[model samples]
Target: MSNLTIVLIILVIYMALMVLIGLQGRKHSSNMQDFLTAGKQGTLLLVTGSYMGSHIGNGIVVGGAEYGATYGIGGMWYGVGAAISFYLFAIFMARVVYRNNYVTLSDLLEQRYGDKMTSIAVALLNAVSNIAVMAGQIMAGERLFQYIGLNPLAGAIATTTIVIIYSSLSGLWGVMMTDVIQVTVIVISVIATMIFIATQGGFSIMAQNLPATSFEMIPFDGETFIMMLGPTALFGLVSSTGFQRTVSCKKEKTAILAPVLGASLILLFVPLPVMIGMYGKALWPDAASGTIIFQVLFEAMPPLLAGLLIASICAAVMSTSDGILVTVTANIVSDIYHKHINPDADEKSLGRLSRISSVVIGIFALIIALQFSSLISLLSLSYTLITAGGLVMIVGAIFWKKATRQGALASFIAGVACVVINKMGVSLPYASVFPLIPSFLAYVIVSLMTQNKNAAAA
Candidate 1:
C-alpha cells in the first residue's frame, strides 16, 4: 500500500481508539464534578501528563517547527515562557487555587470580588480565548492533511468532529489517559528524528550549513522576544486548562510537582523541534515555515512509522483542543448556564448541557480553523487578547484583597478594548502585551476607588 494509504488506515484505527478511550472516561464522568475534574482524584502522573499535553499542544510540537523555522533560535521563547509560567504558578497559584476549591477561573475571581455578573463576563471572555486556542489546535490536523495530499477542509472537519465526540464523551479523566498515549508518540517522534539526524552528522553539520545568526537566543529584537514570550507567560498564568490541571490533583504536593515537572520536561523537549526546524531551513532553505519540521521527520522515518507519527501529531494537537473545548464547555455549563442562567440545574441536566456545549464550541472553533492556517499565529492572537484583558484581573484577584468587582470588570473592558484598537491599525513593539499597561492601570485605579468607597460605607 502507498504510504498515504497506510497512514489513512492507521489514522482510522488510532482515532477509533481515542473515541473508545473517551467512552471509558465517560464511565468516570457521571456529573459535572467528575466530568470537569475527575472528582479531584488525579494522581501526579495524570496531572503532569495532562499539563504536558495541554502546554505542548499544537503550539510546540507542530507550530514550534513553523516558529523555529521562521524565527531561528529565538523560537525558544514559547518554551521559556511556559517554564516561567509553571514555576510562577507553583510558587504563587497552585496552593491558593486548591485551597479555595475552584473549578473554573471565574470561580476563583468571583470569590475576590463577589459579583455574579463579573463571573459571567469572565466566563464569556474565557470562552473566546479557549475557542481560539481550540482553533489553533484544529489547524494542526489541517496541516497534516495538507501534507498528505488530502483536502485541508476535510481534515479540519474530521479532527474537530473527533475531538468534539471524544472530549464530550470522556471528560477530564479521558483527556489525561489519552494524553499518556499521545505524549508517548511525541517522545518517539522527537527521539527518532534526533537519532536519525545524529546518524546523518547531527548538530555539527546543521550549524555549518546554517547562518551564524540562527544560533542567537534573541534572533530578531528584544521586543519581538517579549511579544512572543509575554503572552504565553500571562496566558499560562490565567489559562483555564492550566487551572484545571492544578485543581485536578488531590494532594498538595502532587499539584505543585505536576506542573513543575511538566515544565521541566517541556524545557528539555522544546529545543529539539527548534533545532529540527533550523536544520530544515539549513537544507531546504525554501520550504514552508509551518511545515518544515514535519517534512523533516517524515523524510527520516519509515512509511509505517511516519504514518504513526502523523496520527500522533493529530492526537497531540487535538489533545490540546479537547482541554480548551472542555474549559469553554465548563464556562458555559458550570460558570454561566448552571451558575447564572439556571440555578436549579441538576447534575444530570448540567451533564447533558456540558456535552452539547462541547459540540457547539468545537463547531465554532472549526469555523476559525477554516479561516486561518497559521497555527502559531492563531495561538498568539488567543493569548494576546487574554493577556491584555484578563491577566491583570486574575493577578489582582490573587494578590490584592482590595481588588473590587468594579476594578476587575474595568480591567477586562480596558484591556480588551486596547487589544482591539491595537489590532486595528496600531504598530507597536510587544503588540501582544502592550495592552497590559492600560489593563493594569484600570484594574488598580478602579480597585482602589471601589475599595475606599466600600470601606467608607462599612
Candidate 2:
C-alpha cells in the first residue's frame, strides 16, 4: 500500500477509537459541572495525563525544533521554563484554587473581587486567548496535512470536526480519556524514532556534523536563554488550560501533584525533539525553520513508522485544541450565559448550551486558523495576552486579601494597554516584562488608595 493510504487507514482507526471513547465518556457527563470539570473527580493519573497532553502541542514540537535549529541544545530552555513553572504552580497555586472548589479561573476571580464584572472581563479575555491558542493547533494540524501532500483547508476542517464532536459529546471526560491515549502514542512515537536514529549511527554523526555550539547547554551569547525563560515561565503559570486541569482533579493533593508529575514527563520528552532538530541541522544546514522535525521523521523512518509519527503530531495538536475549546465553551456557558444572561438557568439547560457553544467556538477558531499561517506566532500572542491581562489579577486575588476590585481592573487595563502599544512597534525593553511592571504597580497603588473606602464600606 502507498504511504498515504496507510496513514489514512491509521487515522481512520484512531478517530474511530476516539468516537467510541467519547460515547463512553458521555455517560459520565450529565450537567454543566460534569461537563466542565468531570464532576471534579479526576484521579492523579487522569489529571497528569490531561495536563501533559494539553501542553505538549504542535507549537512545542515545531517551535522547539525551530529553536534547536537556531540555538542548538539551549533550545530546551523554553520547555525547562515551562516545567519549572508547572512545578511552582503545583506548589503555590493548585492547592489554593482546588480547596476553593473553583471550576474556572473566572469563578475564583468572582469570589475574590466580589464583582460579576471582574468575572466577565476575565472570561472574555480568557476566551480570546484560548481561541487564539486553538487556532494555532488547527494551523499545526493543517501544516501536517500539507506536508503529506494534502490540502491544508481539508485538514483543518477534519481536525475541527473531530475535536468538536468528541468535546461536545462528553466535555472534560472525553478530553481527559483521549488525552491519556494521545500521550501514550506520543511517547511511543518518540521512543521508536529515538531507537531508529540510534541504530543508524546516532550521536557520533551528530557530533561530527554539527558545530560545537549545537551541544552547548547555554549558548555563549546568553540572549536566547534570557528571552526564552521569562515569558515561558509566566505562560506556564497563568495558562487557563492549566488552571482547568488542576480544578478538574478530584482531590487537592491530586491537583497539587499532577502538574509536577506532568512537568517531569515533559522534561523527559524535551530532548527527543531537540535531538531530531539537531540532526536535521546537521543534514540540512540551510533548511527553513520548523521543517527540521518533519523532514527528519520522513527521511529517517519507514513508511508505517513515519505514519505513526505523523499521527502522533496530530494527536498532540488535537489533544491540546480540544481542551482549549472545551474550556472556552465552559467559560461562555458558566460565566457569561448562565451567570449574566439567565442566572436561573438549570443544569440541563446549561449543559445543552455548553455543547452548542463548543461547536460555535470550534467554527470560529477554524476560521481564525485559516487566516493565520504561523503557529508559533499565534501561540506566543495568546500567551502574551493571557499573561499581561490576567495573570497578575489571578495571583493577587489568590494571595492578597486586600486586592480590591478597582485594583484588578486597573492592573488588567494597564497591562493590556502596554501589550497593545508594544505590538504597535513602540519597542520596549524586555517587552513581556514591561507590561507586567505597570500591571503590578497599578494593582498595588490602586488597592492601597482604595483601602479606606473598602474598610468603611465593610
Candidate 3:
C-alpha cells in the first residue's frame, strides 16, 4: 500500500479497536462508580498508563517537538515541570483525595463547603475549558489530514465522531484502556522519527544549524520565566485533573510511578519534533514553525515511515480527548445530576445519564474546537480556572480541621469570581497574575477567621 493508504488503514483499525473497547467496558461499568472511576478498582499499571497517556496528549507530543526546535535543550522543562506536579500529587494530595470517596473534584468541594452554587459554576467551566483542549486536539488531527491532501474539516469531523462514539459507550474504562495503546504508539513513533533525524545530522550538526535562543533555558523575558515556573507549576499541581488522577490510582506507588515514567519519557523525546522542526527551519526558513512537524515528515522522510509517524500523532490526540471527555462527564453526572437533581437516583439511571452526558459534552466540545486557534493559550486558561477554585478547596478539605463550611463557601465563591474576572481581562493591565496565588490567600484568611469564631463559641 502507498504511504497515505497505510496511514488511513492504521487509523481505521485503531479507531475500530477503540470502539470495541468502549462497548466491552460497558460490561464492567454497570453503575455510576464503574462508569466514573472504574469501580475504584483501577490497577497500578492502569492508573499509570491512563494518567501518563492523557496528560501527554497531542499538544505535548507535537507542541513539545515544536518547542524543541525553538527552546533547544531547555524546552524539556515543560515536561520537567509536569513531572514535579505529579510528584507533589503523590506525596500530599493523592491519598487524601482517594480516602474521601468523592467521584469528582466538585463533589469533594461541595461536601466541604455546603454549597451547590460553586459546584454548578465549576461544572460549567470545566466543560467549557475541556472543550478548548478538545478543539486543539481536533486542530492537530486536521493539520495531519491536510498534509495527506484531505480536507481538514473532514478529518476533524471523522476524528471527533470516532472519539465521541466510543467515549459515549465506554466511559472511564474505555478512556484509560485506550490511552495505554495510544501512548505506546506515540512513544515508539516519536523515538523512531527522532533517531532517524539524529542519524541524518547528529546533535552537533543540529546545534550548529539552529539559533541560540532555541537551546536556552530561559527563552522568554525574565518575567515570563518566573510566571511559567512559579504559579504555573502550583496551578498544575493543585488542579482537579491532577487530583483526580491521584485519587484514581489503585495505589500511591502507581500514582508516583506513572507520572514520573511518563514525564521522563516525554522529557527524553518531546524535544525531537522541535529538533526536526529546527532542521526544517534551516532548510525552509519561511515555513511556519507550527507546521514544521507535518511538513518535515511529508517532505523529508520516506513514505512508509512517515505514515507510521503520522499515525502516532493521531494516537496522541485521541488519547487525550477521550480522557477529558470522561472527566467532564463525571463532573456533570456525579456533581450536578446525582447530587442536586436526584440523590436517590438508581445506579442504572445515573449510568445512562453519564453516557448521555458524554455525547452531549462531546458535541459541545467539537463545536468549540472548530472555533479556537491557540492550544497553549486555552490550556493556560483552563488550568487557571481549576486552580483558582479547585486547588484551594481541595487543600482545605485535606489539611485543615478548622476549615468550616462557611469558610469553604467564601473561598469557593471568591476564588472562582477572581479567576473569571482575571481571565476576562477585567483586571488592571498586567494584573492578570496567576489565579492560584489570590485564591490560596482568600482560602487561608477565610478559614482562619471562621476557625477563631467557632473556637470563641466553644
Candidate 4:
C-alpha cells in the first residue's frame, strides 16, 4: 500500500476508537457537574493523564520542535516553563481552590471580588484566550494533514468534527478518558522515535551539523530571558485549563499532586521533540519550522510507524481541543448564561446548553484556525493576555485578603490595555512585563482606596 493509504487507514481507526471512548464516557456525564468536572470524581491517574494530555497539545509538540530547531537543547525551556507552572498550581492554588468548593476559576473571583461584572469579564477573557488555544491545536492538526497529502481545509474540518463529537457527547468524562489513551500513545511514539534516532548515528551527528547557539541553555542577553521565558513561566500560574484540572480532582491532595506528577512526566517527553527538531535542522535547514516535525517523523520512521506517530499527533491536538472546547462552553453556560441570562436554569437545560455551546465554540475555533497559520504565535498571544489580565486577580483573590472588587477589575483593565497597546505597534521594553506593572499598581491602589473608604463609612 502507498504511505498515504496506510496513514489514512490508521487515522480512520484512531478516530473510530475515540468515538467508542466518547460513547462509553457519555454514561457518566448526565448533568452540568458531570459534564463540567466529571462529577469531580477523578482519581490521581485520571486527573494527571487528563492534565498532561490537555496541556501538551499541538502547540507544545510542534512549537517545542520548532524551538528546538532554532534554539537547540535550550528549546526545552518551553516545556520547563509549563512544568514549573503546574508545580506552582499544585503548591499554591490547588488546595485553596478545592477547599473553597469552586466550580470554575471565575467562581473564586465571584466569591472573593463580590461582583457579577468581574466574573463576566473573566469568563469572556477565558473564552477568547481558550478559543485561541484551541485554534492552535486545529492549525497543528491541519499542518499534519497537509504534510500527508490531504487538503488542509478538509483536514481541519475533519479534526474539528471529531473533537466536537467526543466533547459534546460526554464533556469532561470523554475528554479525560480519551486523554488517558492519547497520552499513552504520545509517550510510546515519542520514545520509539527517540530510540530510532539514537540507533541512527545519534546526537553527536546532529550537534555537529547545527550551530552552537542552538544549544545555549540561556541566552547571553538578559532581555531574551525576560521576553522568551518570563511570560511562559507565569502563564502556568494562571491558566484556566490548569485550574480546571485542579478543580476536577476528587481529593485536595490529589489535586495538588496530580499536576506536579504530570509535570515531571511531561518534562521527560520534552527532550524527544526537541531532538527531532534538531534532526530536522540538521537535514533540512531551509524548510519551514512548522513543518519540521512532520518531515522528521515521515523521513525517520517506516510508513506504519510514521502513520501511528501522526495519529499520536492528532491525539495531542484532539485532547487539548476537546478540553478547551468544554472549558469555553462551561464559561458560557455556568458563568454567563446561568449567572445572568437565566439564574434558574435547571441541570437538564444547562446540560443541553453546554453541548450546543461546544459545537458553536468549536466552529468558531475552526474559523480562527483557518485564519491563523502560526500555532506558536497564536498560543503566545493568548497566553500573554490570560497571564496579564487574569493572573493578578487570581493571585489576589486567593492570597490577599484586602483585594477588593474594584482592585481586581482595575488590574484586569490595565493589564488588557497594556497588552493591546503593545500589540498595536507600540514598542515596550518587554511586552509581557510592561503590562504587568500597571496591572499590579492598579490592583494595589484601587484596593487600598476602596478598603479605606469602607472603613471610614463604617
What is the lDDT of every predicted structure here? Answer: 0.81, 0.79, 0.66, 0.81
Model 4 pairs whose backbones collide: none
Where does candidate 4 stray beyond 4 Å? 219-224, 455-458
Which pairs clash inside model 1? none
lDDT of 2 by residue, 415-458 (tens): 99998998898987777566889999999999999999888998
Clashing pairs for model 3 are 65-274, 69-274, 70-214, 71-214, 72-214, 135-369
Better of 3 and 4 by lDDT: 4
- lDDT per residue for candidate 1 within 174-271, as digits (tens), equals 88888878887877777787777777886777788778778888878777777668787777778788778777888989988988988888898888
Q: Write the per-residue lDDT of candidate 4 for residues 253-370, one digit (tens) a residue.
A: 8988898898899888877788888888898889777779889877767778777878877876887888898889879998899988999989888878877888889899999999
Ranking by TM-score: 1, 4, 2, 3
lDDT for 195 (candidate 3): 82
Alpha-carbon TM-score of each model against the true structure: 0.96, 0.94, 0.88, 0.95
User: Which scores better on lDDT, 2 or 4?
Assistant: 4
